[model samples]
Target: MANLCVAGGTGQVGRDVVRLALDAGHTVSVLSRHAPQAGSEKHHDGATYFAGDVTTGAGLEAAVAGADVVIDCLEGQFGKARKRFADGGVRLLEAADRAGVRKAVVLSIINCDRSTAAYYASKSAKERVYQESPLETVAVRATQFHSLPVAVFQAGAGVGLIPVFKGARFQPISPLDAAAAVLEAALEPGSSEDHRIRTVGGPEVLGMREMAVMWKSVTGARGRVVELPLPGAMGRYLRAGLNLAPGHAWGRETFVSWLEKRRETL
Candidate 1:
């Protein structure tokens, strides 16, 4: 089995990648800003954790040393996307190269290069960094996660109103499915000459209104689904379905099914 290191291992997608890597019997190491305390919710039994900061290159050499593959699942806050993704990706790739990593995999958003949104632009920049790296890099671009709408709806539910973009549609994939794709890419046999990009999306695409309604039905959330005009480049991007990949509908879980499963957990 390969020695795999996952950056941002405590995040949503990172958690699943770490779990799947361990289940496959690979030696797993997690590089994060803070190591999980023993018996904490973020701690995984089979994986080792390292305190590392990708942007500043702190603790990175130790974290990546002796690792065969590095899966970059790092994400940045709203105003810090460039620092965390573009600059941080460069640092991470440099460290991985120095440590003789064979392969690198990164999670990205579908159609990120076509959008002017700050976050999407930063993601596209990160992809470029990975593509140019000497390591065999695989970029997995996925559609929105199933949890996004829930977060939006939940925030609005507190005020009894859920806003649905007037003309937007979404094809949201489960983080579990996305993580599976990332792990598969990280473990795939390849050389430094090989660099690939792939896309994955949910099983179905639905209007924002339709998804909002379904969310309310499943959660019994008391809120009026208000249709609002989503302005700006991000809105236009969503309305044009630039965020979708119907041909790459690789995920098996439907939005409703995910909601049902999540409800059971809660």
Candidate 2:
């Protein structure tokens, strides 16, 4: 079994990666700001937790020591996003290279380079860091998560109406599905030396308006979806379907299916 270290393993998608990696029988280590105690979530799953912060390079070398593969699921937003996502990645790669780690993997947003949004631009920078780093690495780009649109709609609920972008296209995959894709990238033979970008997305491409309606139906949200044509460079990019990966829709989870599954769990 390989020694796999997950940076930011305590996050929503990162947790899923750690779980799946553990299930695959790899010696899993979680690098987070706070190492969980014996009974905590990170420790309970048979993963060794290491305290580390990639942004400032604190404790990273120790966490990355002897790692065969390091999967980065770090996230951030706005101006800070570039630092946390891109700069942090550089720091992590430096540590991984010094520790003699063989392979590295980083997760990024699909078509982030084509978008003008601050967050997407930051993600694009992060992808570039992996591309330029000498450490064997792959940048896997995934479409938006299922929870993203739901959060947008929920946030838009005001005066019994949900306002959403009229033509925004999204191929929202489940977070777990994205995590599985990342694991596949990590385990692929000789994939570490391949620096090409790999894209993965959901089974279906749905508009923002349609996703908003589904969110209302699933959560029984008391609001009607109001489609508004977003006018901006960012909106133009989204409305053009740049976010949808038509050639790489490898995920099986649909928006409605994911919602139904969650409903059963509740």
Candidate 3:
């Protein structure tokens, strides 16, 4: 276990990464706008909190100083959120570069084909920070987190909201799986030297609507599942081929299991 700096460590995925690292007896420092809430910090045995803004250089250098690795699990902002996220990512990467940190892990998305959506464009750019850097790095692209589907889009006419294009498919994995993958990548540390690896979705191919139904059934939520329209040709292409990996996907979580686990929290 190495000393680690986790950016966006308060997020769903980031929090898990911190937990896994600490469970393994690794020391952790989390970068957030403010220190993570006391409850979150107290759970990790070897945790330190760093208050810094990734969007700017403020306090960033100090936060990452002497850390073994830096993991970025940031979600871009809402209005042109991608640009803001991309810029902030660059700042963090530059700081990492200047500080001479050897390894970094950045979480990217699966449907990040820029032509397909504006969000993808930003995601693609933020990913560049790892691929282009001279530092040894790991870039893991994952499909949407399994349990967060409700937050992705809303279903107006139904209990479950299934956003679809020309039959888009997804292999949503759990936040825990994604977090574990990122940690593994950091330890082994992939580089552009190796083929870019995408930690895509899992064993089954399910439409967004099907996912909604599964979640509803597991949670016994009253939500009705509805299929919504896709916006354009780009959305159609993405819907048709975006989130799936042909085979050999390293996914370890399924929607059903993800829901069952969430039951405890609910």
Candidate 4:
């Protein structure tokens, strides 16, 4: 088993990565800005947690020390994403290199470079940071997670209307699948000088309206699906299906299946 370090391991996808890594018998260490609270949903018993800020390099050395690989799942907020990702990626890579880490894996968005949106731009920048580093890097560019649309619909549910982009479609993958891909990449034997990119997507691509309707039916949420014109570059990006990777549909979980599983939990 590899000594794996998961940056931002307390977040949604990161939490799954931590769990899966631990399940695989890897020595897992989680790094985040704040230490995870014991007994919290994000905290796992087998993994270690380090409170470190990637943006400023604070506590990074300790977090990454003695690890063989670092899976970067760091996330930044809106408007501040560009600086946070760009600067934080550099610091994280430097710390990993100094710790003699053999490989690094980053979780990124599919077709991030095609759009000029602030979030995509930040993701693209972070990818560059990893690719340029001396350590072998694997960039896993995945489509939207199943949680994304669920959050969108939940947010709009309060107002009695769920907005669906008129021409948008999604191939949303489950976080478990994405985390599995990351683990595979981390374990794959490769040259130390190599930098690779992989894309993964959900089993099926469904229209925005179709997904919203399915969500409503499964969750019993009361809301009318309202089709709205998604204007601007982002709209064009989504309409063109730049956010999808049908050829790399590696995930087995469908949106409905994920929803059904979630409903059981609730």
List where candidate 2 sits over 4 angstroms from the true fold: 38-43, 79-81, 191-194, 264-266
Clashes per candidate (backbone, < 3 Å): 0, 0, 6, 0
- Indicate the worst ten consecutive residues by lDDT in candidate 2: 77-86
Work out the TM-score per prediction. Answer: 0.95, 0.93, 0.86, 0.95
Poorest lDDT segment (10 consecutive residues) of candidate 3: 153-162
lDDT of 1 by residue, 45-106 (tens): 98989998887899999989999999999998576656577889999989999999988999
lDDT of 4 by residue, 159-213 (tens): 9999898899999999999989888888898764579999999899999899999
- The reply for model 3, stretches above 4 Å from the true place, is 41-43, 152-154, 157-166, 189-195, 264-266
- TM-score for candidate 1: 0.95
Query: Can you write out model 2's per-residue Cα lDDT over 1-266, one digit (the tens) per residue?
Result: 88998998988788899999899889888899888777766564688888988878999988888899999998887565565678898899999999999889998988889888878888899888888988778888999898877777767786787888877888989989999999999888875354878999999998788877787787777877788877886788787888889889888989998988886432
Q: Ranking under TM-score, best-scoring first?
A: 1, 4, 2, 3
State model 1's lDDT: 0.90
Error of 3 at 231 (Å): 1.5
